[model samples]
Target: MEPIIIDGTAKTPTVKFDSTTGVMEIKGRSIPENSIEFYKPMVDWLDEYAKSSKDQTVVNVQLEYFNTSSSKCILDVFKKLEAINKGGSKVLINWYYEEDDEDMLEAGEDYESIIRVPFKMIEIVE
Candidate 1:
């Protein structure tokens, strides 16, 4: 399956979803004007990927910040991945946050609680 690669902009994050390697990445700020619109493709892509997903899927999310709207959309993305995990494939979410950014860490923990999949909270120095 072809990957979904979206360059980050002032209002969005960089998205790199490579099905071949079962590795997906979302980084940068995610405060898009239309959060739902921006994330729909990702959710859709996950839908397609689920059909023939890899044995292990790893998603790396490193966001500096995100708005309330973007937060829900972000959860939607995680929910999709959770489904993939429930389908028997191992799914790991590596959530990266700045060492001093407690809010970001809590945000990741929130998603970890909501989603059934396992999550690794990675603290980035500096």
Candidate 2:
């Protein structure tokens, strides 16, 4: 599978999904006008990747901010990973949040609770 790389804009995040390494990353702000449209391809790619996933897949999410719509899309991505994990592959999520951002930390925690995949809350020192 080809890698999926999308550059970040003021209203979107930078997404890098490396099929070879099984390391997917999403960073920056996500407040796109159409969140579903922005994330559909990503969710589809994850679905495809799940078929030939690595023994251990790591997803790194470092979002500075995201709107409510984007939050649902983000959860969709995690749900895909959860399905992959349930299929016997080891999946790990590294959720990065700024040290002073309580909301971001809580968001990570919420995702950790909702998704079956294991999550590591990484506190970034701004």
Best by lDDT: 1
Segments of candidate 1 deviating more than 4 angstroms: none
- Give the TM-score comparing model 2 with the true structure, all chains together: 0.97
Give lDDT: candidate 1, residue 97.
Answer: 99
Q: Candidate 2 lDDT, tens digit per residue, 1-126?
A: 989999999999999999899999999999987899999998999999989899999999999999999999999999999999988579999999999999999999988888888999999996
lDDT of 1 at 86: 94
Per-residue error (Å), model 2, residue 55: 0.2
- Which is the leading candidate under TM-score? 1
What's the number of clashes in each of the models?
A: 0, 0
Q: What's the TM for model 1?
A: 0.98
Per-model TM-score on C-alpha atoms: 0.98, 0.97
- Residues 82-124, candidate 1, lDDT per residue (tens digit)? 9999995799999999999999999999999899999999999
Candidate 2, residue 25: the lDDT equals 95
Specify the poorest-scoring 10-residue window by lDDT in model 1: 29-38
